[model samples]
Target chain A: MVLTERAREHARALVRGLKAARIEVVASVPDQWIGLILEEVAKEGSFRSVPVAREEEGIGVCFGAVLGGKGAAMLMQNAGLLSSGTGLVTLHLLHQVPLLLLVSYRGTPGDPLFYHIPKGVRTEPALRALGIPYFLTDAGKDLTAQVCRTWTYARESAGPAALLLTADLFAGEDVYP
Target chain B: MRTSRVAYMQVLADLVVDELVVCGLGASARYWKALRPRPENFYLADSMGQAIPVGLGVALAQPARRVVVLEGDGAVLMNAGCLSTVASTGATNLIVVIFNNDVYEASGGQPLPAAPVDYAGLARASGLALATNLEGADAFRSALQKALKEPGPAFLCLRTAYLPDEPIPAYDMRPLETRLIFMQSLGVSI
Candidate 1:
């Protein structure tokens, strides 16, 4: 019922699913607003966390992980997706590396941060063009179920999949999954 | 005018027998077409500057096997951080060679950062043990021999001219057939 309790449950469920699916590496650039679940999941012994210098590097790192026979995930912000341009289409698209980009969306339509508007508006189109399937999570409870389901799709498709979690999802609502 | 793809493959194939050869994506992977496990095992498509980083992880994880990375000029320009990481970590058994094509051959004939960027200098300044720039197969073979002879992170910058498009075999190494043969060679139980 409480926010913290929901976060704890969702975080555990997400990690459990990642573990069930055999995810071994969590490569990420520190993004505060999204993928708080990953921040918690990373602490477990099975999931090796490799802090990356850039989001593109995270994408590449996950690709390398897959090649090495390990499941991998990446954490970044919505704007960070823009930074992931080269790695996304180049490696994930060309080489067929299965990757998941867990992103935090900063600006939605009519939301704050005017600078984010341009990128926010174009985000969906960009993912489609790259053939990267994306979903949105505006509720904290949706994090685990959506993230796990996306992983299934990513592994099936073997390209990058995404969860563009809204900041309000983590900040606003009181419910947890 | 000087060499064939097989020549490069013969030399590199022997070098990478017990090693992890990270192939930079696009046609650069073609040089490694015949190597055991196929090029895709070591291939990172369009992942410029990714081979070295992945090679570092491989070298660190495997410890016993020497690691070789075949990269491109554009790939190097994209992520020079791999050099810095290799320098700081003191990860030996890693060798990076850039097949400097001077252009992004995969997308379009766009100029690469190679003209403006000095890859050898970048490696040296990153505190690499050895960094050499060379042309031709003989020069490359010599560099390849030396890099394999030693056991510290090093880099070679090879200036290769344009390679015209050819129909490369649809190379994919993740199939069960390939994985079985490759893993058994590594003494891995799959």
Candidate 2:
């Protein structure tokens, strides 16, 4: 599927934000909305991109990266986040390792697919339950700044923080039809 | 005859100096902590099946230092997919040592349903070139030395026997404290 200009721009902004935050390593389990972002990350020279088999494995990777004194982020979808609760709690939260999570907010109101609704409904509550602070991306807001801020907060707090990418940030009219 | 887990750990403790160690949860952590009480040794208190993934991350971030992971058979079975993930990274600085006791020794010696998994074959099939299975402490030590010197993401499975009566010192440090000390040792400011 061809990515819309809007999606491309958003992907670029996300990569730029990761650069601004000095994220040296990224562990990703791909999602449809974040594929372009992953592509951008792979193309970026300064970042080490690790493609993991599972979401929880990505969490462990980020945790180890941070422990090695590198800025790291996990890129995945909300469903992956739901599946990663154990690692997030046992490795990141229990040890207080700073991790920046860039997650696609799938199954939301803007999403046309009915199957995504189940994961969308539980994303925020799951985040809250896990004690992970998160920020939702607004269509009008600057994504780069939002990512940078989230990274900073995770570093300063020495805990995990998430930035959820809403559908409006990447999808155009073509995404619906 | 199966080798003693403690003996293999002692071999590791004696051989490791500058390499970073990531120990799996339960007995692996306890035994490693008791043997190698240092900041470079990151003892996992609760996270089972994540030692290899964490070590892979450390190896990727710090390419100069060797990152060794001490994983149990049960933990490896739980997260066997990590072997593929680690191999895909093509990290030459990581080494995985699985202590295969044929049971979850830490969780009350429950026998693993799939006992005696050929982990070395699994690793080789997963793309790790330097993978071997050893049955004795001397063999493990030799393999570990070779794995450390070679340029590879190596995997070593040591067939070990469980000693329920062996006294392993209790790990008193909290998980947060463990993380801080480990970061400090690595000189990681963040």
Candidate 3:
């Protein structure tokens, strides 16, 4: 499914876009596809990756980091999104905090984990409920533009945005191996 | 240690040597529902167990102020894994005060597994210094006051009661916005 290649390409594109925008101080919970990009972001020495224990906490940290004159990004699974719904609704969204919320799309079409399916299928719907906007990366899409678009939306909305990455992006070999 | 939650907040506000991060569900949110004067910038509602870590990040970012986290039992239990990081990190100026009532009161008072779990012991196990579980207002005041005086990355578990059917006080987001605006005005950053 070209998962690894797509994920790597998307990750690199996101880093480049964020760099071009002079955005740094990203925060994220550990995830699959974003791990490679996070390592890259770390190695670039431009982004200070704040490792958070939960996705919701990541939002609060991101808010604080942004107010401290740095932009932030977040990565977690779709279920993590559900787990953080309250924070997103009240604090991040209501308070108008901007950041990228990249969600690894597990339990989608061919997800192996049985439990994640419900939230996986509800990702977009859930985002809609929280007034969050989101986009996704496919192997064939313009990865950099998509990343930049999500970042721009996050900036303009003054709230959170999501970039959903498919499993193939992580499993693919070219970038993250 | 203090008698009421409001009193605890008042003490913390008076002794709150630093900025604050408070997280909880519906019931706990009521603590700040009335919004007395304080330095806390709470990122609450829907997110439980996230305040301490948020406070940790704030501590790392702005080390000058003491960062206090006002957390509830259910909230703290949800992300109890975070306590280890709190203990292991460079948060010399952080404090976590847990208002433990022994149930998921926000979700209708179902007994939490934390009922059997000694959170203060767990905090000690997580390598936190000054971990103690206390009940009653007097114990809260003495313990909390002493805790404030010491140099610490401390944890205090206050076993309080079901916040009785006190009507959910009316709260407006304006107070919070005012604090944010005030912080911005003071060049304190959000």
Candidate 4:
């Protein structure tokens, strides 16, 4: 997967936002679109990155971090968001722990992969059903500010909030084969 | 003779001090809440199979404080993959103690498939710094004492008896309140 200059910059901005929000721990499950951001997080060194085996496990980790009084986020693809419903409800929602969810909004309009379409379509509805507030990214907008705001909303609400990264944000026109 | 779950927990309550404790859902959590209802103890009343992962997070966040997790056989088997993740982190402050009663004591006394699985072996193979399976009250007390004193990401599996009619007091704290009080106890304001 080739990452475009714009995508790299967006990744950097997202990492900057996380740092600005003082998110100390990030639990992630990789997606092609979010790989650059995860890489940036590693290079940035401001957050502790935990690569989890499953998406639900990431939820548990983030919940624990929040309980310990540190800011936390979960990075994964929209499919992972779909798979993590039970944990989201039982742990974060039931317990009212604040967690920022950074998800690659795959299978959307510009996405080339047909398999991702289902997840893209169901993402918003899933979040709604889970009662998690979300924000969608736009290439024209400042991603750092968007991320910071989403984090703030999560913290203030004392519940999970999601920031969905669109293909445009990642400049994915020719990145995928 | 199989050791009673309460006996093992009694030993733990007597030994544990300032360490943060994460208890898994079901009877184990209910028992812990009754035995030591302290803010330092974070009881997961409903989320099954998540205690270890949460404990790992707490351990990572507070490296200075030891995090001991109380897990049940059924719950651990449900999320056994977390053991590998915990091992990978190599967080020396985390300790997982699995009470293997060979049944889902919380839901009912449903026998976990009759396979004689070695939980300690699984944890060892997963690369934990220390792993041991113990039986009897004497063995668990000594092992737990050693685990507290040692530097390790440890896993201890204790063979316990199934209590069909264990009297577990109702956990009255709401989920949000529990989260807040526990955070307050940890001196974290957010």
Candidate 5:
């Protein structure tokens, strides 16, 4: 199914914002909430799209992209955050590789998906525990500025940062199963 | 038909020409660092199963340059999903050389499963352009030559002997220092 107009605009803004931040590579695993955003990212000619099999692999890809002198962003859902904990600690955190994680905040309040709830509850805690800073954005928030700031903070700190996209951000779109 | 892990790494190191080399944790990193202690070579100290994806990224970002990943069998098993990703992305300039000793040499000399996997087959199944299982120095040399000359996301599974004999010095450099040098070598302004 095609994305709604609001969802499409949000995705486009994210893609454009990342490009403005000089993000040359976008490595991602598909999530229902961010699927259209990932597609928009792929269509951006300036950014090289890399679709990985898993979240940890995307983290590794982003690590290498930064090492090669290009900025990188990883897009995934909250469950992917748990899958990427090892890579987050050992690679990005340890080596001070700056990675922008554009995570879909699944299982947040008002979301009906029960399986994703636990991960959503733990997402903020996990980010805090790892000492990685994050900014949670809802539909009402200014996402363009938040995304750019997240990129800046990650690059400046030489660590991973997360832009948690709330469920409401994909409002009017059929993202849930 | 077995090959020394150190010898194999040394041979491949000689073959590399200004390519970004990423070494997985454990013996792979140790041997590569010992052979070629250069700014371009990233010896990942702790992240297991990350070497290939990192190399794939470098290959993607810098399409003109070659990127090599020297990974251990156990480490690759930790993130074997990367194999399919590498194939799917179709980065032709990337080469993955697995030092398949079939043992966890870093933690202890524990034997892996007796029924060894067909890694070359796995790579081929995963959609790499070229995949081969090589034993002895000649076969490996030949495969490396072919892979270098050809356009491919290639995979080479090298049968190595599990040698815990040579206790190398611990890696002294910090991760930040290595990162700086590597980016500088890549001509990427930090």
Candidate 6:
């Protein structure tokens, strides 16, 4: 999907914020909604952009980066969060490793993808079930703050934290053909 | 013509100096623990098929220190997608060694019915720099030496016979404690 200027700017700011926060690795499995953000993150050149085949693998990759004295973040859609459930619980949650997950809030109302609805509804509940603290946002400014907060909480609690990006955030973006 | 698992590990322990090791849960982890009990060795307790991904991350982060993933055949099969992921990252300082035993020895010797996979061929197809399947200890040792020195996202498949005679010792420390110890050893403040 093509990014709206507003969405592009927002993505840039979030990327810059993550870089400023010293996130050295960005592991991702793309979703159309978060594609621009991941693209922007990849262009920055400061972080090691890892494109993973499975979202769960990103969790392992991110945790490994953290162990190697680097901060890491995972970018994916809500379905990825579901796919990564085991890794999140067994590795990060069980070992108390700090991880930052930037997940797209797919299937939220106003998104007509249809299939994403089920996961969208269950995303928050799943996060809560796993005891992961999360912030849902559509505004870029709020995302910046949420990113900072999530990272802080992850380190402080020695657990994983998440930032959920809503579909409304990219309302004006064009879908890729 | 399968190599003894202990012999393979002994060769690995001798070859793996200053490298961070992620041992997949089950026999591979047990073998690694028995061979090398250092803080640099991370014995994964239960996260199957994740050892390679974790090793990939470490390799990317460090870029200089070699990161080795010692995984079992069953574990690798469960998350074979990791090979593609690891290849995509193209980390030069990474090496994945799969212990191919043809069965899920951990789950009580249940045969893996998913058909046989040629791991070295898969790694080559996945774009790793070096890939080989070794049947003898000498061949494995030689290959491992080259794999260590060469720039790589190297892959090695060591055909192994499962001998369940020795019991894997239970790790007294919690997973977090083990992780902290490993990280702290690397001088990363928890």
Best by DockQ: 2
Q: Point out where model 3 deviates above 4 Å.
A: A1-10, A21-24, A67-69, A106-122, A138-148, A166-177, B1-3, B21-29, B32-35, B39-46, B103-114, B135-152, B161-169, B174-179, B182-190
> Which ranges of candidate 4 are over 4 A from the true structure?
A175-177
Output the better candidate (1/5) by DockQ: 5
Q: How far is B157's C-alpha from truth in model 1 (Å)? A: 2.7
lDDT of 1 at A57: 67
The lDDT of model 2 is 0.89
Model 1 segments beyond 4 Å from truth? A1-21, A34-46, A109-111, A138-142, A172-177, B1-10, B34-50, B53-66, B85-93, B101-116, B124-152, B159-190
lDDT of 5 by residue, B118-170 (tens): 88887888787588888987788888988888888889999988767867556
TM-score of chain B of 5: 0.94
Q: Write the per-residue lDDT of candidate 4 for residues B87-168, one digit (tens) a residue.
A: 8888999989999999998877999988899999989888875999999888998999999998889899999999788766
- Candidate 4 chain A lowest-lDDT run of ten: A168-177
Backbone clashes, each candidate: 3, 0, 13, 0, 0, 1
Every candidate's TM-score, chain A alone? 0.82, 0.95, 0.84, 0.95, 0.92, 0.92
DockQ (0 to 1) for model 2: 0.82
CA displacement after TM-score superposition, residue A114 of candidate 3 (Å): 9.6
The docking category that best describes candidate 1 is incorrect
Q: What RMSD does each model have against the real structure? A: 5.5, 1.3, 4.6, 1.4, 2.1, 2.3
Tens-place lDDT per residue, model 2, B51-73, is 99999988988999999999998
Return the lDDT, model 4, position B7: 97
Considering just the first chain, candidate 1 attains a TM-score of 0.82
Q: What does candidate 4's lDDT look like per residue over A1-177, in tens digits?
A: 467887899999999999999999999999877788999999998688999989899999989988888899999999889988888888988988889999999888878678989888899998998889999987787888999999999989988999999888775677552
| Docking quality level of the chain pair in candidate 2 | high
Model 6: CA > 4 A from native: A138-142, A173-177
Please give me the DockQ of candidate 3 compared with the native complex. 0.27
lDDT score of residue B74 within candidate 2: 88
Model 3 lDDT, full chain set: 0.68
Tens digits of per-residue lDDT, candidate 1, A27-102, equal: 7766544346666775667676666666776676676556655677877777779878877886666655577677
TM-scores of the candidates in the order shown: 0.72, 0.97, 0.76, 0.97, 0.95, 0.95
